[model samples]
Target: MGTSFEKVHDYMGRRVRGLWQRNGKFYQQLLVEQPDGQVAPRRILLKSTTLDNCRIEMAQKRGIRDQGEAASEPLEIPSFAVCCRRYFDFHESLKHGLKRQTTIDRERWSLNRWQVHFGHLRVNQVTRVMINGFMQKRLRGGRNPRTVNIDLINLRQVLKYARDCGFFTDQERLPTEGVKPLRYKAPVRPLLKDEQFGLLCEKADSSANRSGPILADFIRFLGFSGGRYKESLRLKWKDVSFELRQVTFGSDGLSKNGKARVVDFNPALEAHLRIMHARRAPDCKYLFPSPQRGGKDIPASDLRGSLFAARAEADLEWVGFHDLRHFFASYCVMSGIDFKTIAEWLGHESGTALIDKVYGHLAADHKRRMAQKVSFSLAQQAASPAEQPAVAAVQQSPSAVLPLPTQSGESAATTALAS
Candidate 1:
């Protein structure tokens, strides 16, 4: 018989050795010959408990090698659902600190949506066609491109985790390659007018919710600071400097960007914070503590119903809590605050790109006023003798006579010469 069919431990560029564990279990260690004739060992647990069965399996593997066939079944790829669980666990195990609970919840929701369609499919089976189909399905279900892209982002992360775990060796297994996220233009978020904001606050303060006043003040605080909804809620009295009129969002404050930033307050906001400080419970660590739970940060859900109710009462149903922040940026731009200053106040680390994208469009009134100011200044400058062409023309044409009014008894030429 050929050496390939021999019951020897090594054959055809591969070898299998029996390994006995201390617990009496047997394993098959596969040694594959490298291109340079070096052997690389890979240990695989044996399903059979006895060493005889392991030898039999090894002989079978040797027989397959003799026939030039693969000695084992293809490696099993994990399903999308399994990959998502593993991904979440991996993120949870990171030492740097996991994402916020709300962010994880959002990821869970997005992954669940993906699981509904691709859970049974192996991670390697997700192709560009499958991803495109998912995008089409989401669009048909009335999801916007931006919303659909968020799901894609979550899916991509899961696939990347799978790749990192050695579930796939082929680059094509990752569907994110040619699969482009759908593009959609976002509408400019509207800002509340001064009168509308005042009315909204008035209605919010008088609403049936016992926390109505607190909610109103919270909205005003967001407007003044231009802080994100969560950032504002995470504020503590210690972060505020009454003497310096500044509020610092530091590492302990849970800023979105994970960096420290200081925002200066106007005189109005400083006074507002001082008043709230006086009414704050001494034990409360949060600036906006929940009325129901003293010393605890206010829950976002607590104010949703009241905010919508107040908006309805003020006849400004289009307004939202985030709009207050937008209102601050919009008015800042309109009032001639530079984009850099606005970006700093908003805790943006990437410079003014965001400000220019969102708040660069000034209000019509602001644009008109600016145009008028420019026109008046230019008109005044143009009226100066140094700026006029008439003086230059007269100097260039010495023979040119001024057309003088014929004085009561004087001729025109004589009147001109009187100078």
Candidate 2:
């Protein structure tokens, strides 16, 4: 806030500051003499937010450390290192199980990489330009857009945490806003109709012969339910309610977002599941347990292997299991189901963006069909009321309107029967 270094020097003329080093990093805490003659430890620790501003303030005042740790010695500016340990501790405490361990690990890795890049510099010395420079360096180093975005996200989160904890006086001191990262296109690979049938037939027949009906039923289950790969893999016996004809997955199981939803079962899947229940071991917890490893979780690799073998046997191309879910969604759309319904079935987070990205084509087709229906309805309304009755009567009695077939299997008279 001082216009000149003399002003800041005169203001902090008599003050006591504490200094210490930990984890090869030095930190300083200082008490300033206020205008009212009151002394207070208004800590100005350096970090990504205040790094540059703090340096400017220090240089302006020529702030110095007392040599003898007492009032008798002249002051000298002390070099303080940014405490990454402190930053990480604070981050971990704030996160506190809100995020997964893998996520926390990623954040830590991002922070560490940034620290290694500029760790020796005081936290208060960080500036928008320096931050931008770091980003440019990362991009030049061949980091992908998504990776760069994640790093920025992690950094922003840490900076926000620091601000909330009063580490930085100015919350908006860091330039975290308006930094846009590139987005890549989503890869969609829906299974073809023939591929779907072949996968089913191959899985069913192979597993049936190998005493692995559970594996066969599981493949069929995914196709019918359109559940996510993890959701299908982690399904337990209790999750499937036979009487309700639905499989419910919630937080206790593999529902990642801790959301509970039910997937309705078709007749084919229901019959298959009924047979499975009868043959399943009474003590088995999982609906599809590992055949060789008792009491252990089903192996994702084994399922992939089975799928690969089936694909090869059926002479079908390799496709991810997720494609089956997409195929199911496409089928639903083609069968006249609405986007909202499809979204619910797939457990997708609702919004226009997801619909635009995932089912945009289906939505456009739906709109076209709706427009045609509206045009037809308007035309029918403009016609005579008697014509509407005749149309309704014909629809109501197809047998009465259709001509009977003769013994020779030809129509007797191309004429209508009694109406």
Candidate 3:
């Protein structure tokens, strides 16, 4: 940093606050509150050379920009908490700000903890050692690597903002630079299989209560459509179009992506919807009305308790709502539906990338069944290399029943001929 700047004085010869001169022009630094409610500095070129001109311009600019905040003092970089608040307030204005409300909510939650950890420290006071200690403490406190990384992320967002505010300049070592994010090993949960699905449905079907059949239909809907927990609960009767073979999930704050989506109906999804439609309450709009809502017309908040009971009775207590969702995807894949189409049905934002990452692998029998669809013959060589490459693929089709190297020995033009 420069040791000094030529200071601007008032007409009465008193040094004016936050007025500096460089290259025969004056600059005025004004204090203003950011949209998210953090006070920060904003500098403006005064275009003034003399003290009278500088003072007059400064007063005029302050009247236009500054709100009712206190007079500007010597511009000092605010504390970490201030910088954090500033960043969060203006996050929407940032080029790479958080797009999803859920992400913003999660990041804010993470930063709240961080604020209590180092809120009092100046931006420059937060060091790499403190960050490393916080990481260890979070891990020791029973947070997984992924959760602890949230804290690290929130901390770095502020520090990076501080850097933009002119704190760490000229390739300085960042607090989170050497700290490596721990590799996240996602724990595998139980997936519903064909027999387990039947067992659960049987338990629901055999239950001795009004909620039994409803619960059975709910499970069927989830298995058939891959609807998320709340999305299914929020589903309405009008959203189903049996004629169109489509079910729509409108944006009702329950969708994971906060947008409406339509799931194309398969045979099972259609059958499940028709069954539910026959028994749906005339007074209610939701597909799954609350099991307890006798006279009240409302959607079921959750069916976890009912699901748990059903799972226990069926001796498949490890099953969850997401297991059925997985079952739907797996069922589609086994039926030979492409992943891109599955992702759209599942309301995924990354198209097929997430589906392929999570649901790509399947049972060994299924893999073998898919593999058998490919065929090859090991006994022959081609008469011509060029001819072989073109015809070989057609010959390798598993549908081909060859009596010779590349011939099926039957023609459509002559079904049967006199030999």
Candidate 4:
């Protein structure tokens, strides 16, 4: 077996970072961390040679330091099932990359289903055709493309590991080379309206199970803060800094992108937090302590059961915990908050990409009102200074220039032109 020594170059003849090519096949060099806090260089074969894929993998593997030191390479070739287990074993020993238990758990979930299909086959026997068949079967069985793509991702990682362990010869083609993820539009979920939130709180407050009031508080907390449910579940009372007018989302690297963020107080979030603090159980550390915690102190694991009841009573079957997050983001947009600032509050990266795509939907009335604010030309640019008064008057009295849009949404100018 040859050590990865060749540095790969893109079409522009520029040297790429941590990317290497040998014999027309591309591989990415990763610094996998050992349990003892030292990192070891492990060059893994890529499923595809495109720079985009390499960059995506690189981002996911960031933060592990590489000192250009080589690690002991595994020499064992195993079945797909064994490879899956070993893959997890390798991640378990890592102090850096794949360090988050949440990410590992998600990977395990995806790989478990993958192993069920390819477990009996040897690592080398897993081919592109078989992978396509599995994906087709999953889609036929009513699984969405997003989930199927996740399965493919985990499988690709195991295959890469198997290749590193000398499972594949140099001449054989990578099985995942031609496989593309299924394209499907992400559905835009409806946000929880202000009135609906009030109704939900009312229903929750009236619950007979004594669980209703807590559920109301949970709703308000999420609705105001735009927090992911899991992050909010772990939020402690001490994380709240009234002096700073903000609540930190627990320890650093606890968020989705693995960074701690403090949500500054809005009127609703401030009011909700204060109310919860006043009524909080004295011995509890978490803001929302579990009523089930008799002796052992712990936060409530979930509020789904009570949410189901309140949702039913409020007749809002489409509402979800994440909808509260959408509610916060959408309302922020409506209030003229910038996407970058909102993204910071929500812990999103890459500027306003995710914000503009997912949470930027505005209410119809809001959109219409904003549409009224758009001007195609500057007053000075559009006309001479002497004519500016007429333009200004026309702008101020839009109905005089052209009658307002009618009930059917046609302007009087259009009506006159038609006549």
- Candidate number achieving the greatest lDDT relative to the actual structure: 4
Q: Give per-residue CA lDDT, model 1, range 107-149, as digits (tens).
A: 9999998889878887788788878898899999999999999
lDDT of 3 by residue, 300-372 (tens): 8878878888999999877898888999988887777888899899989999888878877753447767786
How close to the true structure is residue 68 of candidate 2, measured as C-alpha lDDT?
A: 25
Give the TM-score of each candidate.
0.70, 0.60, 0.66, 0.70
Between candidates 3 and 4, which one is better according to TM-score?
Answer: 4
Return the candidate ranking by TM-score, descending. Answer: 1, 4, 3, 2
In angstroms, the error of model 1 at 143 is 1.8
lDDT of 2 by residue, 300-323 (tens): 335766666666666666566776
Indicate whether candidate 2 or candidate 4 has the larger lDDT: 4
Name the runs in model 1 displaced over 4 angstroms.
1-75, 170-173, 250-253, 294-301, 363-368, 374-419
Candidate 4 lDDT tens digits, 323-353? 9888898899888888888988888877799
Off by over 4 Å in 4: 1-75, 95-99, 164-173, 361-367, 371-419
Candidate 3, 44: how far from true, in Å? 17
Per-candidate local distance difference test:
0.73, 0.60, 0.76, 0.78
- Off-target runs (Cα >4 Å) in candidate 2 are 1-96, 106-116, 119-127, 130-143, 188-194, 200-215, 295-302, 305-318, 351-353, 363-419
Q: What is the lDDT of residue 190 in candidate 4?
A: 71
